[model samples]
Target: MSEPQHDVDPVRLGAYFALIEVSGLLRHAIEQQLQADGDLTFVRFQILRRLQLSPAGSRRMTDLADAIVFSRSGLTYQAGLLEKAGLVVRNRTPDDERGVTIAITDAGRALVDAVLPGHEAVVERLLFDRLSQDDARTLTDLLTPVRDHMRAAPPRSATPRRTRP
Candidate 1:
């Protein structure tokens, strides 16, 4: 039996590979900076950063998982680690006992503040410095729709999980 072929032109194929390569390289650099400056993994930094940016410095676990495109189980584990480090606190929502909200601590905010300068510098050096103003605008324009389209699918937290028999 032979595998079926789908049509993908060379230009699109090259663009896809280039995007993936660039994304991987950027993530590696960011991860190193996060680890060095804040003793954080990329996902943990993302979670902390998101909570830090929220007006109330907190967010529901499911919402956080969906926003960061992380699995709920993985986010829960990371949250537990953050909780242990005194960087964040988890509390059950008053309105919904089943729902948990994760809030950044003062320590968490301080850590984010400490790490941000290096993180910004690394991002500036690796990405922004390489792109012209117009190129940056165009890149954002091109990618925004793709991001929105992908996000239109149900978030992972909202998807039903399978049960074992």
Candidate 2:
């Protein structure tokens, strides 16, 4: 019951390699800065940043995991750390007794605010500065469809929930 294999193309392989390599380098540098400056892990920073950007400044825990491409248990563990640090809080959603929402605290916003300028600077220096304005736009245009297509598919996670006792 093995799936049929297609011949691999060198160009496509190179593209995948470049994407992974660049993403790893960028994440490492950003994480170092975030840890040093804000005492935050990259995942914690992302959770805070996403919550900060939400219209209601909160999101259901599952939705946050899906949006961030994090495992539900992993996100919950990170959220627990953030909560312990007083950067976030988890609350029961009023309408759904079983639903839990993660909300950024004032401290979370402050940490994000403090970390953002450095984050932008690192990104600009490492990634964007290498590209011309047109290059940036073209890259975005090229990636948008690919990203959207992947997102349209069913989620990769089979059990996308944190196990609650």
Candidate 3:
């Protein structure tokens, strides 16, 4: 028996492939620039940016992992490196002993400040330069729903912690 014809035709597949290719290339360029300019990895840069923008310059480890789609253990390792570098602090949350929070340090903030210009330049040169303002807005509008939908799903590291009564 022949396979049934369905949606996801050549056009859709090509579009998906193009999107993936662009994403990978853009990430590579950004990562290279980030490393060359400041010796920072993309993941570490993201963590610092998130913590810097967060209220109180901190977020729970799990939340940070979820936001970055990183494994909890992976985030823990990165946080450890940052801690050793004096770029961030990791401490148990007072309200929940099982929970750990990662906070950006002054050094992390300074590093981010130093890195932003290069980061912005890389992003703009790779992404924004390829599209008009309206095209960028359209891409955001189209992708936001897909991003929200994926984010709403159960994350891989969302293990529940038991609380003492």
Which candidate leads the pack in TM-score? 1
* Per-residue lDDT of model 3, residues 1-165, tens digit only: 999988878988998999999999999988998898778999999999999999899999988888888889999999999999999999999998789999999999999999889999989998999899999999999999998887677467644334579
Q: What is the TM-score of each candidate against the true structure?
A: 0.91, 0.88, 0.90
* Runs with alpha carbons beyond 4 Å of true place in candidate 2: 1-6, 158-165
Candidate 3 lDDT: 0.91
Ranking by TM-score: 1, 3, 2
- Which sections of candidate 3 miss by over 4 Å? 1-8, 158-165
What value of lDDT does candidate 1 attain over all alpha carbons? 0.92
Q: What are the Cα lDDT values of the candidates?
A: 0.92, 0.91, 0.91
Query: 2 or 3: which has the higher TM-score?
Result: 3
Candidate 3 TM-score over all chains jointly: 0.90
Q: Which whole-number lDDT from 0 to 100 does residue 159 have in model 2?
A: 29
